[model samples]
Target: MFMRGKCIGCGCCTSRCNADALLYTGEEMDADKVLDEVFKDILFYRKTGGMTLSGGEPLMQYDFSLKLLKGAKEKGVHTAIETSGYYPGKLYEIAKYTDLWLYDVKIFDESEHIKYTGVSNKLIMENLKYLNATGSEIILRCPIIPGINLTDEHFEKIAELSASVSSVKKVQFMPYHPLGTEKMKSLGREQKYENCEFLSRDAILPYLEKIKDKTDKILEIM
Candidate 1:
């Protein structure tokens, strides 16, 4: 019923919810407070292991994210961010504090990108180039969705970026899976890829071979 748009945006449902499952997932935390939580895993994040800020788009909270990254850096922890490269000047402002960028390029073509993601890829492409200019280490993260973007052209475009961009030190493939279908169903929402199967590492084997033939950059399947 929720996914069918039956529930209005009012707070009635949340106020009445007994399970406490749909409450806000975020909390107010200053950089220090967040760091307190992070340091709990200090032993586990010994050497190359450190904080990786993922999102809903971390740049949405630019000031907090910057402060958090700054605090982590001061403590000598390697910092990485998984981002869509959508935020304009903010990325450059925080680039120095970010040790690595798990930058996403969902689709290479602007039209196709807008068709699938409902946004222009122009800013994303620009931000990526700008980030590259900053000499930041980047691992190009590409999602290989079976029916959506599991195509030769998409892989080729990714290969092109690795070959042309000096900062793109490697390529990482994030294959699509139906793992979220159960959650979507639980919420009474329709799953977009309901018919799609989990993408095994072997599903991208041929594309990997194709990309390998195009660039010498390191490749990882995640």
Candidate 2:
């Protein structure tokens, strides 16, 4: 039997059951419907912005993602993806259709990454390297969680990594907030990082200062 609290929302259970017994908690959207919605703001996209595919891991739905991106590109819409880089072998395929990649680089250490996210960083790092080699434009995003990954070493590592990648255009240091705590509660899931204080921009400035000179890419504390 599947235990309630143990579920990590990986969608593996839904795939394993041929009956589709596990209903999705979120609404399903089709590629055509998504493209229609995206095309609605053509002026906005034409002027300064474009569609960005973000997720619960967008690459998890690889076929739909590829189709969506290809459709958007055909319509002359710039495309971007906000990803955790956890997926296997498919990034190269998607890279061809992408304009900008807002890639997340959480904890630099391998063990700490597995401890917090329940996955090793090996795949993530490997994917990043592959993407970098392809000369794809990228923005490295790191969430600054207090007492978690908010450290000088983490910032330095990020800077070092970004510096090594010629295609990296920016490094975004995202401050952690408890904006999803209520959602977790509503889902009847325990809050893993309970009472973790939100890290302010002021708190993150020092780390930014330490790595600012290390990389030529724009460093934004967002």
Candidate 3:
């Protein structure tokens, strides 16, 4: 049997199905229409925010993301991207069109990073270094998840990396919440962090203190 519908290419069906039948129903959007929507908020963007390309991983759709950023830049609008820095080769080209980068650094340890995210940190770290070398403006965003990555060592590593990178403008420590648990379940995926503790600003303060003097970059709990 064959299933025909909008798949979103999330790969949930492929993973859960006992039968090897699911295929990716590629995702697409009209570039002109997307830019039209982005340009509609030009006035508000000028005042505070700007065009930001984020994703399950924006670079996963490298061509579309590149065109989107390019179009935004051509329209004299500021452009930013929130990325996991997983694709170093694609990032180098995308970085050229981006004005600001909201880069995520989950954990510094190689094995632990792979254990939690199911991917190695080698590519992520290499891309970060590439961004730094190219002078791309970046803000490091780290999620402080209790019982997972909320540790003194994590913060210290972040501080050290931030300090070493000349392109990093700020370090944002994001407190993890289980807000997406229901959504994950709805999509036929397991919620690994369902019972995970949520760390408040106060809970993250001790970790922050460990790295306070290590980096001169602005640090904020968000």
For candidate 1, the 10 contiguous residues with the lowest summed lDDT are: 1-10
Q: Write the per-residue lDDT of candidate 3 for residues 83-144, one digit (tens) a residue.
A: 98888475667788998889999988899888888899999988888888778799999988
Report RMSD for candidate 3: 6.0
Over 1-222, each residue of candidate 1 has an lDDT whose tens digit, in order, gives: 245466665556666779986674566788899999998888777786999999879988899899989988888888999998888565767999998999998987788788777789999988888888888899999888888888888888888888888899999999997778888887776566777777889989888888797887898899
| Stretches of model 1 off by over 4 angstroms after superposition | 1-26, 43-46, 185-191
Q: How far is candidate 2 from the true structure (C-alpha RMSD, Å)?
A: 5.8
Full-model lDDT, candidate 2? 0.88
The alpha-carbon RMSD values of the candidates against the true structure, listed in the order shown, are 2.8, 5.8, 6.0
**What does candidate 1 score on TM?**
0.85
Candidate 2 Cα outliers beyond 4 Å, as residue runs: 1-27
Lowest summed lDDT over 10 consecutive residues: which window, candidate 2?
20-29
lDDT of each: 0.85, 0.88, 0.85
Measured against the true structure, the TM-scores of the candidates, in listed sequence, are 0.85, 0.86, 0.85
